[model samples]
Target chain A: MAKQFKSLHPIKFYRDYLNQNVRPDGRLLSKFRPVIVNTGSIATADGSALVRIGKTTVICGIKAELAQPKAEKPKEGFLICNVDLPPLCSSKFRPGPPSDLAQVTTRFVADLILNSGCIHLRDLCILKEKLVWCLYADLICLDYDGCLIDACLLALLTALKTVKLPSVDYDVAIDKKVVNEDEKKSILIYNTPVSTTYAIFEDKIITDPTAEEEDLSSGLITIVVKEKELCSVHKPGGSPISEEKLYDCIQETIKRADLLNTLINTAISEQTH
Target chain B: MNVIDDNNLLMRKVNCKLDILSRPDGSVLLSQGDTVVIAGVYGPIEVKTQKMLINKASVETFYRPKSGTPGIGDRLYESIIQNICETSLVSALYPRSSIVVIIQEMQNYGGIISCAVNACCFALLNSGIDMKFLVASASCALDDKGVFHLDPDKLLSDKAKANFVFVFDNIAKRIIASHTSGSFNLAQYEEALELCKKACDAIFDFYKTKMKNEIANKV
Candidate 1:
């Protein structure tokens, strides 16, 4: 029966593959699945990107709106990022308010954006403390395989790079702001952050675990790196991992981040050309 | 009687791909011009006791906007899609069950409601559900000069005096649902309706070709 196969086959197949030091998809224990990124695809949003890691797909759309700058952060703008995991992606989630996993993922992604400091908030300010551009990045998962954090990070970064803001003009007599659509400018990105997730099962570390692997893993860790700097090391407490394992994960994350940086740069250039 | 500087007006070409997502029971990504919609169909599986109906299946639809939280505007589209699906699908075959259709907006240059309706039909077809007849929808906009344009883009739709989205069943070529925005006189509304009915023919042809090609590729 389909039910029996669904529950038994993945466990047995994964265990056999692990014993052989490989994955069910025929990759080494530390090998990651392929990632693909497409930028500026959505017409409604000012900027958008679609990212796919293995079978996991995520779409990030960035909409720009104008609002008053916070008095405390007079020269700075704001960035709002939300991650939505609807039931269309997988059967694990139902339709309603975001589930616990979604909330956790959303917080992690928001923290990653703040800690990475890839974007300069000051640049979004049109008239300091008066009017500022508010960028809202809405990332929706269309498929749930595994490694959602990595896909979201990649999509968000690419979508930001594709954003083009219209020039604003302040009319003194009219006392109103006018947006000039003919001349547009792109946002400056200071750093490009990429995240890598690993699942630990039976003293083995698996990179880019699938949905099934995630459920079976004893612990999960996500390492975020931007160039040589470490932004965040997220381990939400399932099983304690040793320092040596953590170090190994960080090193792997650095290598992956470097590759992703180059990938994103190439995509940006390809679009511009 | 038409008045306007002429030519260079054509409907944006529509492109579609079926079964793009693996997790959904039925899925489709459909784009008309620059507007794109992704639809997923799941159902005839299980239903809660409260929602279950003894005589027929319960149908539900959720429409998500491109970004931000879904608001009252999206609910309007959801109801339209639900009604069209209820009309086309043979729910009597699966009683006490539920069928869910989730539509995600990818882009919206114009004709968004029609695009969503078309995508839902494709998703339903991909799911292999029992349907009394295949359905297709088209939107026609009438400009200030009384000229009817088929599949108008956002620029035209914004300036149009009136626009209407018509959903038609393939069997009798009768309109199953019609949604109108802006204002038009009786004669203008009838002209737009006739234009959309004729446009549906081309859309139906597109559906046939796409299915035929898919079947050919499979074998």
Candidate 2:
């Protein structure tokens, strides 16, 4: 009976649930779904992770290749983040070049990766201008439930944590790189930024929405938190939110970041064992 | 021939996961040694006017490289994969529609073309699309010592004199597609083809085992 009403009058159903301070998925208004992280799942990728938040599943694979450093930044390497929302991930996405949503998400994630200072590009440099590691981190959405940004960020961070690069020595005389397969080292990660997404349904704020809730909501806010500092607050052209509500979101994200940090560390440690 | 050993004939570790993505009709993440490719199949759906075929479904393929936009070499890979898929798929069964195959290159240690082709086949199988016959591909590298290395890594391939990729059908195991680079004599070419044919059989067996496991899980 509830399912029929949810399908017929989705907004009304959500309003009824919101009136009782609960969500359709039985989560409280501010409660996030359980997050599951698995690292080093793809052997081919230098670093890889599969993350699940509720029903949304995302896989991130980081492949490190040798490339010449850019002219301007001769000492730093490149970190490219791309998010793919294929037709297999959601019915709304079609088979073709990446959609607008995908492009935006890629840019947003790239910005967070660069601006957060989580990964030092200089650490990726091997031979200054001659050769450096170009990390291609590709995040593919396997299932689109909701809280996509949250899942993508977690997958990227965990995958980055698991990356191991084979030591490469440059022979100056021959101008060639000799990779030592026996010696491998992990990249230095400075910070682990976790993102939390919230949806504004009418006047009430709901956390970690599903696909159905995302559609019916009037606005969406994604907050990226690193430790106690706020890294980014992305509210893309939705209904205006109050300052206090936004502050509450950031505070909530700070707490969530601590929990996610522990989760990511445990996942990585489990893989090592 | 003198340098070729029995162990060299064995292909690298091949791993695959089917139906990994929920939205696509069929999807597979396949890894051949260190070269990994993810492929998704969507077919018998609405077709654009320009790409639609009256008698058969049009097959389209897009190959996305790891980092940058698809360049000339990437376009060449796309056409090669599209032709192979068109030949293997029974497109005539779904007329006035289209079958789209999208392959994303996740990692490339060596033999990426063969890995991508095999990944596409696995994705098609997972989608349960009608096909004339299943296809599997194998790659080998010819070194300066006149020896063939099956599933060469980046180190071997970079120092190789020539590289070869061959696709074969499961029914007759006949050649479906062949791509080669560098120069070699006719005898060397024949020898390389023979080497790849045997490797492709192992891929076919892998596919069968994967399908059997998938069925058992469902039951």
Candidate 3:
């Protein structure tokens, strides 16, 4: 039937392209789409950035607010990363609550950020247990093609860089806290983490897979690399891949991290200037 | 060429595919100006006693974001879609039942809410559900310079002075639901309303072509 052909045609086309060591979009297996980043675009948020990877777009806004420190981590501040893949992003998600996909991605990015040691919690602490900066990094996907984690991480890092935290002083005279909006300080980021996603179609690995490619692929592997170190290698419940393939992905991710870091640095400098 | 003509963002074609999934009673994958959505409808099914309506079918809409679970902002979209569905459907015909619309987002450039509504409308029609009239939705945005645009892109939508999402019933061309954000004056609001209403004509035509193509494919 035509319906069967309709579904199978794309898979066959991808297979044909894979056989030639090329993609339908005319990119190599390790090539990534052109990435674009714009920082401090959202005036309302303390820090914000819009990041785009090919057709996929992610906007991240960081809202820093004062809050009581946790009883256990009294001396440490908190960073809550919430990644939103709204119905605006793609047809894969329904409109209502966060889907399982969103939660998984959020947890993955949160872990990546934490494991990368990009933002130190102790640096956010102010006045011991009395006051601390609660950084809320909200990453919203406006367009979804693929490589969402990569886009989200880039946006979060850029937005975090753009953040200007106001100086806070406790007024002993009136038992109040006076926030100095004029004196703003940016947070220190130790390392830059960039994620590279690959879709394993049979023996071939497709970099930055489109939504269609992802759906057709047998497995998915996401690698997060910071500097030259592998921060996280997330391959959850997919077709079996060889150890060599895994190592190759990591190497590709490392190379990609370097390229993306330059892009991020250039974007940050453009915004700062 | 002029700047307005070069920015053919609104002139892009819309693609719609129906009955893509087997599980749902009706399903549609709608793509407009890079904004893609998949809508599924399961209706006239049994409803839980606690959530059932005695006189009319209970309408439940579940909107799934691409990444995270639904939050407060999603609730607003759900409510808007719920209102539009409630007004369009003759729910009394299927008492003590439930009609669930599940919409999935793919790519969003702009005019998301309007696109979602349109997808839901098509899915409902595909489901062969009884309706008082067909519904079409369009969005209009007033940029910082006070220029009016139909189905504005992300950049314009982000910096626009005001934006409006309007749903219209096919019968009397009356407004079924209107959702607006940001700020605008009375004249601007009226201008946006008139512009959106005009934009709906093209949207309705797009729907007709989609429906015809879907029917032809089935045959």
Q: State the lDDT of candidate 2 residue by residue for B1-219, as single tens digits.
A: 112357777688899998889988999999988899999999878999988889899998899999999764576577668867877888889999999999999999999999999999999999999998888888898899998899898899888877777777888675556655544554676688788878888888899998999999999
User: Estimated TM-score per prediction?
Assistant: 0.55, 0.56, 0.55
Residue A270's lDDT within candidate 1 is: 84
Complex DockQ per candidate: 0.01, 0.01, 0.01
lDDT of 1 by residue, B77-186 (tens): 77667767876889999999999999999999999988998899899988989988887888878788878888899999988866677777787675566656554444
Runs of candidate 3 with Cα error greater than 4 angstroms are A1-8, A172-174, B1-219
If the candidates were sorted by their lDDT against the true structure, best first, what order would they fall in? 2, 1, 3
Alpha-carbon local distance difference test for all models: 0.82, 0.85, 0.80
Ranking by TM-score: 2, 3, 1
What digit string (tens of lDDT, one per residue) describes model 3 on residues B1-219? 111343522434567888899999999998877889999999989999987988899988888877788765565577667767876789999999999999898887888888899999999999999987888888877787878877777887887766677777766665555555544444565666677666777777777877888778879
RMSD (Cα, Å) of model 3: 22.7
lDDT of 1 by residue, A201-220 (tens): 87788999999899878557
The TM-scores of chain A alone, one per candidate, are 0.95, 0.98, 0.95
Error of 1 at A202 (Å): 1.3
Candidate 1 CAPRI category: incorrect
Model 1: lDDT of residue B21: 97
